[model samples]
Target chain A: MTVEKISSLQNPRVKQLVKLRDRRPRDEAGVFLIEGFREIRRALEKRVPLRELYYAPEWFLGENEPALIAQAEAAGAQLFELTKSAFAKVAYRERPDGLLAVAPQWKRTLQDLDKIVAGSGGPGRPGSTTPATTSAVGAGAPDLQRAPFILVVEAIEKPGNLGTILRSADAAGCDAVIVCDPVTDIFNPNVVRASTGVLFSVPLVVAESAPVLAWLRAQGVRTIATTPAAEKLYTDADLRGPLAIVMGSEQYGLSEFWLKNCDLPVRIPMAGQADSLNVAMATIITLFEAVRQRAW
Target chain B: MTVEKISSLQNPRVKQLVKLRDRRPRDEAGVFLIEGFREIRRALEKRVPLRELYYAPEWFLGENEPALIAQAEAAGAQLFELTKSAFAKVAYRERPDGLLAVAPQWKRTLQDLDKIVAGSGGPGRPGSTTPATTSAVGAGAPDLQRAPFILVVEAIEKPGNLGTILRSADAAGCDAVIVCDPVTDIFNPNVVRASTGVLFSVPLVVAESAPVLAWLRAQGVRTIATTPAAEKLYTDADLRGPLAIVMGSEQYGLSEFWLKNCDLPVRIPMAGQADSLNVAMATIITLFEAVRQRAW
Candidate 1:
């Protein structure tokens, strides 16, 4: 198959890729970028539809780029080969692996979460209203046979922190991640890089704090909010059952709404001068605590 | 007292500050840069000697800058007030906070760790040979009557990860953090920022791997090396007693030397497609596991 070639940086597609780096363009176009071999590969594995792929062989660090490019093309993505300078113009990472893809933006509302809560564990399993044996399958499969384990964040500032949180949530086997009023959008290129492509594997949704809180309460999911002023230690809190760990922004912690609404408020003990851990670090610590409790 | 003012970016002092950003100039000058109000305040609190202070009022983010400048001056720091444009030239952060400092570099060998080991629990504590309650009544004093807790990192490439690790170590109340064959220098400006002033609070040392291992063995500290192939889960390991959690680099796991020399090998459970957690996240999880175990 002959691939289209674009050697000039002035190419409209290249210019569009650069513009997609910012949120307004990405949002208006209803698509975002997935860069590097690992990120593009993960998107393909998760069956995320790729619209187009741009490649530059001179920038590839390893032999696997050809195979990944082929796979992306086979997945019905248009292929474009660019000069190294052209690729560098659009590549977000310091070191580009010579592969980048454009994927359609996805959205999930609070209403979709009902399917997750009801799908986990077998049918008629205490609090779950939906039958697990129902024809629910694919990405949101109910294979774990346990109560729903969710992670929710409010107004995280850094794209790197948000992405790392997603990666950590996936590592802990979270059911879903619902970002509430994010300062940095999930589709930021840095977010994709920092997430290490876990963005594709994890079920993610973005919504307002009030609606997420209401949905969690309705689903019977116990909410645990992390804050520095909280009297209860995170370690002392009971983390089992249908749980959603609520984390706050880096500078200002969980808003008054979450602290008042969450079922329990907990603090990770701090012995040092710094008042709090990085949001991503705190999320991992809190989520793994739940993972530890659930292991029993 | 009136502070010396430098309005020109071409001034020798301003040029030196910019040069200090890179590793070679920093090493040659025997001083590293510490920027931002919180970081300088933390250094003052820790009694870290400040050789010089630079300030630009136009860039001050908060009202506390005047008080902090006064305090730095009181501590014998050479003060220089710079124009906004001059300060921007020397600033490392994208958003300059208008405060920066130059402090002389200090070094610590494995032998210094002996002081930490002996200083943690009181005199005659098990595994400690030196008398702790002697004239040791200063910063490394025996405040916590428990076994020595340390964190060791090998070839961590990112300044942000190293800084976050230090913060985590401080939060876990570790005795010290020893960087083994560091790929990124401990004094990198980003490390200072990412640590959020924990750098001053925590006892940190940069050394080679071989001697650090030998010293740990001599001090009777049990080392826990984190790797994906390890059979024992991190939580299952008894994190009590004198402990050192050894973390590897971002790209590669522990080097063969560490994997072979460390006392025990353990892994954090991973359910996601990503093979491992970010080094900083993994460090926090393992250290907090130790913290939780010791709490009990």
Candidate 2:
């Protein structure tokens, strides 16, 4: 028998789910969410902690049900159920994916990053005194080579755009993502859903522009700014260098200050009628450009 | 103060608007659509004809109102008034943009492509005998160089992704976009909304894959296929040649048959954990590579 709780839309859990619909809840609770069957399954299978799991009884029932129930029971996840209508209210999309989860935020400190790197089996980071490849670190070695490829989204709006960006970035083997001045919250349910749980895997750093810039500089990283005004095209830029390509918002573009200040300002050339490209596209090209460069 | 003859929600006009919401309407009417304030404004000001426009009288009277009404009227747009709820029903998003319009679908054929090139005073097209050296093509000259760099997409699904790709392609100055096995109509209201009317300006062609592939071959185009399995990096490939970079859907990637049968199979290198870059990003980087190669 399932643990049952019948509650109105005003119930505390439901309210928490509503607040979780946006980014505010994640910041407040130090927890973010994941949704859809595949994503939630990945999180559970990976031994990631789940603070909550909501399923539609009407939609979910199978031989695998007991395992899911036991896993949540084992992890002490707050298990809840809602009728399709009630579940519908909390889900961002009109169709509920039959399962939803709230996973603990992987709050990582700078020292945590350093510790993980030092623990990798490799000699050390490429530039660092210690150098190691990623595979070398798996057996309790600090492999510098396995260090996550960092994706820094300078300024972006539109949850769907951000989600797609993250999903693609994740698929490309990026180590993590740092979103500065994100238009939507990293924890927004839609982002989690759209990213296909890439947000969970990515160590997303949210901060103001200045500190983030400064951090990258301290790391001796190259900052590549994307713009139409630049003379050099993206492919021409040396993307293989430890780089953090900066992308701008939908409207104005990477500010002139960023252009002047960035280590390098590169353009993606236009061959046709429109003056500029979309922010999402710019981010993707910059990312792949780095990939192409690295492969060289 | 508003023309209200198309009063019934079931009116043929309303049905057309709803149908236009889907790509089928775009096909049936042989026209696409645009929504919101600025986009519609530009389209009208550019002498683009409007089949019909829907707006709530009180809503348009609010802020930034006069310019919209005048523009629509001067363009001879058929205007209509709808109850707030009814208008929302016609619009895709829950909230209406205060205005939406249907206009002719843009379909520039391949025959005229040669004509467009002769107009471009600059001989910029790769491998072509003529060069578009200047921006001064006479009335009789074709702007073949209006965009010499062209990208052909095969069976893309998401409208947002297509719109984003167009935006990026526009920034790259891509000549025209030919969608082969298109999943969504290029002129869908959402795609148009996403492209900011760049859709209107960009010469798009919708056709099947086989014919487009044949045409590219006949053009002596170096067709590059982007896939994860390829051994060569995107940068390693010669991008400056007369090329038609064929990129596939984000989900399935370039079809296996497409990859086996096409000219070249190439991959973009990835680091960290991701398998691939987002499609739009991939397109931009791929297109930009050509622009960069040609620039220097």
For all candidates in order, the CA lDDT equals: 0.84, 0.65
Minimum summed lDDT over a 10-residue window in model 2 chain A is located at A132-141
lDDT per residue for candidate 1 within B87-193, as digits (tens), equals 99999988989999998777766775676776543333112234222123113533456788999999999998888888888788788889999899888999988
Q: Pick the candidate with the highest lDDT.
A: 1
Question: What lDDT tens digits, residue by residue, belong to model 2 across residues B75-136?
Answer: 67777767766666677765566687777765555543444333444333222234222122
Positional deviation of residue A60's Cα in model 1 after best superposition, in angstroms: 2.7
For candidate 1, the chain B TM-score comes to 0.92
Predicted candidate 1 versus true structure: per-residue lDDT over A1-296, tens digit per residue: 56999999999999999999999999999999999888888777666788999999999889988888888888789999999999999898888888889988877677756767876433331122342211121135444557889999999999988988988998998888999988999999999888888886677889999989889988899999999889998999999999999999998989999989899999998766556377888899999999999988
**Regions of model 1 farther than 4 Å from truth:** A120-139, B120-139
DockQ of each: 0.45, 0.44
Error of model 1, residue A184, in angstroms: 2.5
Ten consecutive residues with minimal summed lDDT in candidate 1 chain B? B130-139
